[model samples]
Target: MRTPAARTRAGSAALAATAALLLGLAAAPAAVAGADHRQDATTLDGLAHRSGRYFGSAVDNPELADTDYANLLGSEFGQTTPGNGMKWYATEPRRGVFDFTAGDEIVNYARSKGLTVRGHTLLWHSQLPDWLSSGTWSADELRSILKNHITQVVKHYRGKVFAWDVANEIMNEDGTYRDNIFYKTIGPSYIADALRWARAADPKAKLYLNDYNVEGTGAKSDAYYALIQRLKADGVPVDGFGMQAHLALQYGFPYQMRQNIQRFADLGVDVAVTELDIRMILPADATRTAQQADWYGQVTSACLAVRRCVGITLWGYSDRHSWIPAAFEGQGAALPWDEELRRKPAYDAIGAALTAAAVRRTG
Candidate 1:
């Protein structure tokens, strides 16, 4: 718990090499499930609730159009994150003009389904409107623009989203800060300012800084640990650290993920497996699928082991609509459900993990 900033920063030279090995870590299969074989009384959310945690999934607008897809989503999980609706490009496509049409639709749907929403992001280097990214502006102008965007979006969704990613994927795989447009235009202080503006707009909404590959102890994660420590010392409004946990079985599960969560929890903030998904090389086999199941249980167990780990969210719940196959060519079949909406071994693994955590709470 002592400042990891100094201890970690000293090893900056070797950080980049570890990060380049694998940008992320993560795998899945099929069959029909009947009432008799399933645990009739336990839902993933129900078990998580007993342990004071939540089981959630990320949802995009297109998936909601399919009833079966929507049904499983609303029924199985207690929380949802808009996969793209709340991004700057989607919400404010033009400078000085804004549209909340898409974001609002997702928010209203979550409300109807009794699911709480998580605002995907207020600041990110990708998916930004062409206008903002292309324009060449002075330091003062860009700074104002950033604060305005964060303020406007957070205010629009005020009480609806319980947590806002605030900033997403702001660090590179290496332990160094990413040279995003924000960093180039306004320097590193932009992160602190962005979080503060978000807090001002929606004080009740928990503010988080989210990134991938930080679920384990490594040079990349060490960089974040140091950064969060410095941000806290400066009185930044960072409320949580979100580990995307986008795992790939080929790279193996993250090293000591539980201890990683605990270290950040000691920083005095909540932690979450914000975008959990496990993938493997193409042409899936039985052994690889089983390993994927074990990783899922480990992730759930890691979260349950920490006092401040509040929730777990899959990037998507089914391989049918996954972003993986496209994102990682040859790597697909990443969720607990298969293309036919059938539960896979991963489903049972997660359920067992949550049930065990609930039992531990009572024991």
Candidate 2:
């Protein structure tokens, strides 16, 4: 597998091809274009705010520096998550060594755009610096390390971030905690400890335990439910649950998404659709595109139904800079916008959902 740097360079080339594809699709006629833009309607954040929610997208550092992308981000989204800049590896390359350059850059950009920021994560098993990943440490030693890291990073972002993915991908698919280093070394309480340390560092930022495949009813989500219930009972500072809705058409939509969200809300915490994207086996056709669009509306509808579902955030907003193609071979076209910054069917579908939701409130 290519390193992230290599993939990023390759992604630029993919963007060029995607842009060409967008130009070809752009010639498809005016009616399609009009529909794609949601009838030249209001921004996503505008539509979401009407229904007392936020609409947001994740952003990486390089893309935020692009003028066109930056402008679109400012106008379209109310919140942003740094795709990687705030992660443990990026922030601390060595034991006791700290770096905030990348994260600070993103935070400043989000503030400039009047976009509230969500910290991507406080702890995860992957993407750790070599010192931590390869070294051996006792249980108490690892626990101290984790608490110190979480406290510092959370303190740095403090009032700037609305929430933190305090613990991420902690559970495996079968409703059990993955055998990650944190779990093995610090035991299950690492989650509650992480949340507590983060809360102490920044009392205002909402703390969340985020994971993929938890958007629907399943064993994995059930595990999260039990864990959350336990944590709440013990008075953990967990403020929200995050469902990383990374869907693929080949696998079918999640089973009864609304109920899945509602259960978490009933547990007394806000829920968010974080890192959302719908990818299909490549060479997108009208059929696949329409399916993707419909899925977007459905996701928004599910989130709207639950009062505590505070928001929906796209993993990244455009096909141009998406991590899909690289991460999942032969699969792409997973976002609402095409490479030329043009809205696709999914954009209109999302627009329609948000508008419909707001209308229901006003009606």
Candidate 3:
């Protein structure tokens, strides 16, 4: 379709008002009185399941040691993605030498919780092993390396994961392809080759091209929209577009998010709100927390509005284990749960949105 830049930026104000109403209604006396009262009720995943979608969280290996955090994660969410376990650096630290220790741990944990795993990232520009990044390789050599990496990884986790993020963050903010190692060494066709290789390894697993800043209708998202169309026309196996909703309060909400999701869904592929976290300025106040909760509700509502928008996975479900503090200095407290594993305003907002969707489905 046409460029999203041409459309007017809309819907943020309306979504904010909607979230305020939901939070007011959902934050009843009983929900606020008891510390663990909400825990006994239907979870976010339980509500989402009514409308045929899954709710999930990303977990790092270290955080599994925290029993309280792990238990909440396992029970409240229906799916889990390893934040760094399935990445290239963790999976293959050396050339031709593979390790599945980290990924396997997450898969086993997810299985125990009856949560399906989402294989994150077969290919990415960052977090590559020293060997692969340090050495300069010809196009053919890098292509072979990519194929082998994708093939082996997908083969290993074939039936375990429901989907594979075959290629990630491949596009730049301006809708141009990023000058990543794969693009620089193997050219633009590397993405298609990676998808094909993964599909060959596991035909049952859904293949996706994932990236951040694509939740809105803009140049970055427009790039993916065009790229997916081209891939489909070429008979490539592309199953979904992942909008890593790593939102920030300063950036405002994604422009026309629901409409943007609909456009992608219309293109005949599923859309997912993968890696969701609404970060605010450090030392959050009531205003910032409310805004964060509003954004969370808006995202949940947008995904629920679309039939093909399959699921949402928070980057991390709690502030205790968030990557935000380290990654985005001076900015933290991005998740729905606090450091103590207590539900925050955002949690109630998301719950309200999911609850509303469930009611709509059964009503």
User: How would you encode candidate 1's per-residue C-alpha lDDT over 245-308 as one tens digit per residue?
Assistant: 9888877677578999999999999999999999989888997777777778778989999989
Q: What residue runs in model 3 are displaced by over 4 Å at the alpha carbon?
A: 1-41
User: Tens digit of lDDT per residue, candidate 2, span 214-257?
Assistant: 87777899999999999999999889999999998877787578
Task: State each candidate's clash count.
Answer: 8, 0, 0
lDDT of 3 by residue, 1-363 (tens): 222222222554354346446544334332221123123245677668878899889999999999878887887788899999999999999998999999999999988877889999899989999999998999999999999999999999989999989899999888999999889988899989988899999999999999988887889998899999999999999999999988888777775899999999999999999999999888999978877877788899999999999999999999999999998989999999899877787877787777778778889
TM-score of each: 0.89, 0.89, 0.90
Looking at candidate 2, the ten consecutive residues that score lowest on lDDT are 1-10
Q: Using TM-score as the measure, which candidate wins?
A: 3
The true-versus-predicted C-alpha distance at residue 58 of model 1, in Å, is 0.4
**Candidate 1 structure, TM-score to reference:** 0.89
RMSD of 1: 9.1
